[model samples]
Target: MEVATSNPAEETNVWGGGTRPLNASYGKLMMWFFIVSDALTFSGFLVSYGFSRFKNIDSWPIADEVFTHFPFLHGIDAPMYYVALMTFILIFSSVTMVLAVDAGHHMQKGKVTFYMFLTIIGGAVFVGSQAWEWKNFIKGEYGALETKGGQILQFVDQTTGKRVALADIATPIATDRETHLGSNGVWYVSETELPSVSVAEVKAGFEANENVVIRIQKLDENGHKTVLSRAESLEKINAATTVVEGANLIHNEYGNRLFADFFFFITGFHGFHVFSGVIINLIIFFNIIVGTYEKRGHYEMVEKVGLYWHFVDLVWVFVFTFFYLV
Candidate 1:
């Protein structure tokens, strides 16, 4: 072994010439690797969503109809307005991150801190907006009926050609039904809270409201939900077994249950990413205020975080296009 012994240090050296590959430090390179892996994960989710939507294209919930709510704009039909604002804020935050990184490169601590503060604010606002959107989605506006075969039957005013909420059309009916609890019978069994309106109440209301018609989940050639004739609506309403008020893992008043499933999973996952980025930005922002990066003689940490922020924004672009625009 003494004749030609290999040097352990040389053998273990991954970077042949230097630790910085392509002028990127180890931390920056690692961030790139993490971003690539994360991008692949998001791609997998979006692909699965595309396949599911394609299979149930006709029954898929219309994005405009589902995301019509805006802050303090009750009874207003503003489709995609709030969602577009959220997207704009996120993208603007990415721009601020770029500015912060550029300022850091010039050793301009003041500019870097200012831009970082702006970026953090934008991210926080976006996260809050996402939470608001989730609240509205889980507590759906207009209610619908679910058939035994899992089809959704929405109500619409024939004269106005607009959706009608169950609260407006559903008659109040007294019932002795009660929510099932684990302590009531089986120790491990329980039922979810009962819906606000019962199926029988909705049926009676439908009968009383002659102007309301049933809108099936199936889309017509014009890309709108198929509205049934008055006689057909009566027949279709008879097939409904349950009144669904909001969306959950099991039921969605909008349309196909799978649409809700994908919406929750994909949007929830993306929202988590945005929220994590915000927290990380806050930590970096505090460090900047404390002169941590200034003492280090470089702002490479800011650049590293900037890369992650940009990746989050880019992923949202794809998500927005696929989920809302497409």
Candidate 2:
């Protein structure tokens, strides 16, 4: 006697008569849920960022003025252009990903391979651009002076309209000498290059540079930096440059530490997300080339991944608006 077996293909037959529900495979459902949770996590970060920005509304540095660097545009005030370009690249990659999914629907292997390759290229370029941005930020421009209270103070020259470094203005009051170095006394450890300009150096630079002036933390109702006219600034300094002091969270030579901190954290987190998405996409792309999905006779995997790629692009849209735009 032969035993009857249920057919996998027969599961969808109605009127046998119970119809099988068109259930999404486990992988696709899990991906959807993961994307939703991850989106909430990002939302929490952005909401916190918004709160901080609101709390410090009056003193926050204008985002446009702060991040204006663009590739191949030396010294041009091309604010938002570079980041906009990065956004376009990611969005275009999402488009290609969708097209790849469409081709996979028709079982077009060659087209899928081509589009996936393009997506990978776009992701690589975006990651490289982000690295360049980080380098520029970490190196910093026009540099700020850190106060005893850890605030930042920035210097500007009225004539040059450029940021002035503290080192350019002030000479440090050298301390007592000859408390020399030795393994026992205070062994020298491997040292890293200092990241910021010291406040004393900023003061000396201010005195040395004829065009330089100080911008104090306190501003009038109009939101301008408390400035001294060139002559008055020099006169006040000569009388007593002791007005110079350290920075705090409330005040800093660079502008606001919170601004810097928020910038580093938010963009850094977004960059990390982009990095992970690229890795996942690459894995899928390789699988396509190796015939894994085609052998299964279903391209739903490509569609699912396309959804994720689009979601990444969507997150970047908000990030650009908040971080680089208004």
Candidate 3:
């Protein structure tokens, strides 16, 4: 006698009109799908960054030189120190998240709550650090001169081989400077704010300081920015069309405006993800507090959010490698 048999493939298929997929709850399976698609999206962004970086290999900004600012160290030059600390904090938070998930598995609500709280604090600190970084980038440190041909020329001390800020080297000038706003000039064009110093002021300062020379954006044989001769420095500063104080989509004190664009886009996207993960973590935290999951007899929500938090931390690892170390 031939008996009808259930099709295993049909039973396992999620969209084959099956109720449960691979014994996964609908929510868990949906989260997995979202994570996979998001991974692909991040991969695309990083790949594009790599290609662009290779194309602009000569003029790319050095990450250490760019991210050297540390909190409460106004005059200190500590390259990559602060960012390394931020990385450590994030990794430690990931460890706490792992403990949270393990506790959830054991149905230990108290441990889960404590670990989740620690994770939230770590995430908050990371976000705040990122904001500080952005502020410094936007404000800039040592100012550079932008040539008409769209190249940056930084100032350095010939004796010390260290960068000299325009604020320090430039002579004070009193001029009737007016920032042309939309109401005062073209309807579509306006200046955000006048640069702290003018090109004329910078020129006067550079000419007077015999110890200072110009460091053009072009790299030398040893993979360092090329420093011009005293005479060349004078000639190079003459081509200065504008003062580039900080980074923006239009102008970057760092080499290659494209670098700033990609930095903002990729980092901003990742920051948004961290922000979202924190919100979700908070919700799960409250649920655990109210014994919602304790009643339902499972703590799958905590596990799901843990997966997301781990992914976020993992993404930052790649971002820190490429954006800072590499």
What TM-scores do the predictions have? 0.93, 0.78, 0.92
lDDT of 2 at 150: 45
TM-score-wise, the better of 1 and 2 is: 1
Q: Give the whole-model CA lDDT for all candidates, comma-separated.
A: 0.91, 0.70, 0.88
Backbone clashes, candidate 1 = 0
1-326, model 2: which lDDT tens digit per residue? 01223676665564562342445666777788988998998898888888887887766676665677898887787877889899999999988998999999899988998998898889889889988886766555555554455434566778876666555666666544332335436466432323233435445667667788755544558866566677766554443321222222233234566766776677778888788878988998999999988888877788888878888888889889988887
lDDT tens digits by residue: candidate 3, 131-240:
89889988889989999998999999999999999898889889999998899877899997899999999999999999999998778888898999999999889899
Going through the candidates in the order shown, the clash numbers are 0, 22, 0
Evaluate model 2: give its TM-score: 0.78
Q: Among all windows of ten consecutive residues in candidate 1, which has the lowest summed lDDT? A: 1-10
Question: Which of the two candidates, 2 or 3, achieves a greater lDDT against the reference?
Answer: 3
Q: Give stretches of model 1 more than 4 Å off.
A: 1-16, 19-21, 187-189
TM-score of candidate 1 to 2 decimals? 0.93
Considering only N, C-alpha and C atoms within 3 Å, which residue pairs clash in candidate 1?
A: none
Worst 10 residues of 2 by lDDT: 240-249
Compared with the true structure, what per-residue lDDT tens digits does model 1 show for residues 1-326? 01223566765686554333366677888999999999999999999999999999877889999999999999898998998998999999999999999999999999999999999999999989988988999999899999999999999999999999998998998899899889899988887788888999999999999999999999999898899999999999999999898899999999999888988999899999989998999999999999999889899999999999999999989989998999
Shift of residue 54 alpha carbon in model 1, Å: 0.5
- Model 2 CA lDDT for position 198: 40
